[model samples]
Target: MSTQKPIRKAVFPVAGLGTRFLPATKAIPKELLPIVDRPLIQYAVDEAREAGIEQMIFVTGRGKTAIVEHFDIAYELETTMEERGKDLAVLDPTRATPGDIITVRQQVPLGLGHAIWCARAIVGDEPFAIMLPDELMVGEPGCMKQMVDAYEAVGGNLISVLEVPHDEVSSYGVIDPGEADGALTEVRGLVEKPPADEAPSNKIISGRYILQPEVMRTLETQGKGAGGEIQLTDAMARMIGTQPFHAVTFAGNRYDCGSKTGFVEATLALALERADMGSEIREIAQRLLRD
Candidate 1:
């Protein structure tokens, strides 16, 4: 067994007011929006479970109780379904071992970095994974699983990265890259939302991170940056030299469900892949195209 500290908990920052997805998100937390048969947050949580994360820490905000309830076992529904001979297995993904999942309220919408810092109490001193529910990463073994495997082999702060168009580099936290081999790239530094011409690299952080607990300390004093919010990239940048920082190239398709176009694309992509609905969805898409 590798001697590195095991990643047992995953922090999910779901407090964002999904203004990009409103007015549907008016009452519904954007994370609850469905992709096909599952909500956006469900895909993220499933990815965490795929990596053997034992505890889920959701840093929530006002009007986000629905997210917590989504993972809770429905006693009444299950009992009724049992009487009707319904397969209980469909709900298996919704269940988390009691006490294994918990929530902390991030009272203000400071930034991604601040939201993560809210989970510091639960995370304690152990290394943990962070998943942005808005980014839908699809693969056979899942994206976080790929990062955890790399984390086991190397041991330190790791972020999933993808090479985006240079024009889009200004929209994401990008890494100043160094030595690289295969999927691993040494993180020389990090820049959040830098202008394309100023960006050090085209590789952008793809919303999945395996970070050392020490990041919380850096974040505590981290002043607002890049859009006047405590940028996670800024804190991660501060710890790069002190800790072994690297980026893992995710071998998967990532859909940004946080945006309207990306949300539609994810729905169509996933819907058209389902065994039960693929053919019909394809036909519908074809007919719509002809129309």
Candidate 2:
């Protein structure tokens, strides 16, 4: 039985008007926020590339033109660095060539489902990966790659799931398991941001998804489930009986960069991992705590 289905395209929804970050987000896209030296979205794209994704489709919104430009080649900057014999460390990550990237504008202020729907004409019909830039997963093999391997073994719709606190289950899409292996669970049902007491299980959706093309059709008419938006969970829930849906409970640390605290924590955590800046970052945090 061949499980692999030539999953090449990936859809990244970056159109969210990050109101939570406020004034800072006014000028900058939340996806562009720095995680160490690399912007958050770059990590998402890098993860997709590592997982054998061929085309990068960024679903962007107004005021997100810069997002398109960031992935483009900066000729002047590259030329200057080449002439000066300076190591273009910055250009290393920015080296994703022109054709590999594509952008579609989500003119309306719709939810994640709508943002994905915008890429339908381009995506056509294919099993694609969806990675939210805000969810930064730090792991040995990268989160998406782990999911891709699992998808090969399991051969169905795969979602990256992790156990969060029971109290915090309401903050995420909860998954109910029918059968469980070491790191994979046969998904019984999906609860979108249920109340703490009503949540089916502690396993919550973390942002990495290896979804089937049929999901796009569901999203097209998903209407609105949670928060009055066409929830992706609502669509996924519908596919339970027809297709094999499983949650891959892989081990990794995920940070919610959408929130201020999460963003700051990610910055400090990554900074502490760097050889040049770790000492300075640790000392500053220690001094701040001491004072």
Candidate 3:
């Protein structure tokens, strides 16, 4: 067997009360919001599956049952589609085998670290991936697959990063870059939401992460940082010098679907990329802009 354990499980922290898109989010979990034709969580799960993740561990809170039902087989819907002569291939990406998914409840509204900590039991002792449903990345090979390939070569904690404007650095966890190698950057340290002048680098963590199991232990005693809630960045920052920490620059377009602007942009961008509707959407877009 390979000395490095295979990353077979992915933890999805879906417990957040998406206050950003309220009203709509009041009833529906933000993860279920459709980007074009697929929900944001579907993209995350598909990306995880593409990266060879065998089990999906969802850290969910109240009002998130729709997410679980979305992945499970919809008997009536499937039967209706089949009888209506509709191809069920489109639903393939959302369907999961009975035991392939596992869910854990995060009783309170804590931070990202706390949500992930909820799934530590299911993750056990193996390295696992973390996929945030709100960050939708579109790329040729998929973001998680790219990180997995990098993990195979580097074999430690890896996170996907993208260059944001210096002024925008305060909005994300900025990376202090130490060395450069193609798309990989040696992460010297991480500064969570640093001031613009204090940011070490423009590269920001982009939600996809391949982390070692030891990070879970670190979170056990990690105190709340930055946002008054347990922040995953603070825990991972402690592991920097001890482990091989690297940031993989993603070669793709990422949409912050949690925001209104990014959500609209992602929907329009994806719709305009579809072969059947691209031309129509392009014309509509042009017409609207001209008016």
Candidate 4:
């Protein structure tokens, strides 16, 4: 067994107002939005579970109850499905054991740093993961699993990064790199939303993160950065030299479900990958393109 602390918990910050989706999101939590058939949050949970995460910590706000209930046992629904001879196995990935899942209210719309800091008590002193449900990553081993395997080898904070176009660097947290080996890049520094001309590298931090408990301590005193909010990048940047901070360049397809375009693209991509819907979806795509 590795002597490094085992990562058993994952923190999910799902308290966003999701204004981008407008009236549809007015009554529904954006995280509950269905992509292909499964809700966005379900995919994130599935990735966490695949990576051996045993406990889920959701930092929620008001009007986010649907997210909680989605993971709970739906007695009536299950009974109906069973009576109708429907497969219960399909729901397995969506359900969680009673004590395995927990939620804390963010209460206020602070930045991502404050949202994560809200879960400090539940996360305690162990190394934990931070997964944004908005970023749906599809891979053979799943994104988190790949990071977990890398974490076991390096034993420090890990964040998923992807190389975006240089002009788009201003839209993301760009990394100042050092040494590199394979998929791992030494994150010497981080610049959040820097102008394209000033960005150190085109690699931007993606939504998946494997962070240490010490980062919570750094977030405690982290001031507002970038968009006048306590940005998680600021706190994480402070930990770069103090700990083994590295970025894992994900080798998979990452769909940003946080935006309208990305959401539609993810739906189509996933639908095309499904055995039940692939043929029909492909045909529809071909027909639409020819029109």
- Each prediction's TM-score versus the true structure: 0.97, 0.96, 0.97, 0.97
Clashing pairs in 4: none
RMSD, one per candidate, in order:
1.1, 1.4, 1.2, 1.0
Please report how far candidate 1 places residue 79 from its true position, in Å.
1.8
Compared with the true structure, model 2 gives a TM-score of: 0.96
Model 3, span 1-291: residue lDDT tens: 246778899999999899999899999999999998899999999998898999999999999999999988888999999999999998888889978999999998779999889999999999999999899999989999999888888889999999999999988988999999999999999988899998999999999999999999999999888668999999999999999999999999999998999999999999999998999999999999999
Off by over 4 Å in 4: none
Instruction: Quote the lDDT for 182 in model 2.
Output: 88
Better of 1 and 2 by lDDT: 1
lDDT, candidate 3, at 107: 99
Which digits, one per residue and each the tens of the lDDT, describe model 4 over residues 1-291? 677798899999999999999988999999999998899999999999999999999999999999999999999999999999999998898788888889999988889999999999999999999999999999979999999999999999999999999999998888999899999999999987899999999999999999999999999988888668888988988898899998999999999999999999999999999999899999999999999
Judged by whole-model lDDT over C-alpha atoms, candidate 2 comes out at 0.87
Q: Output the TM-score of candidate 4.
A: 0.97
In the range 134-175, model 2's lDDT, one tens digit per residue, is 999988789998998888887779999999889999878889
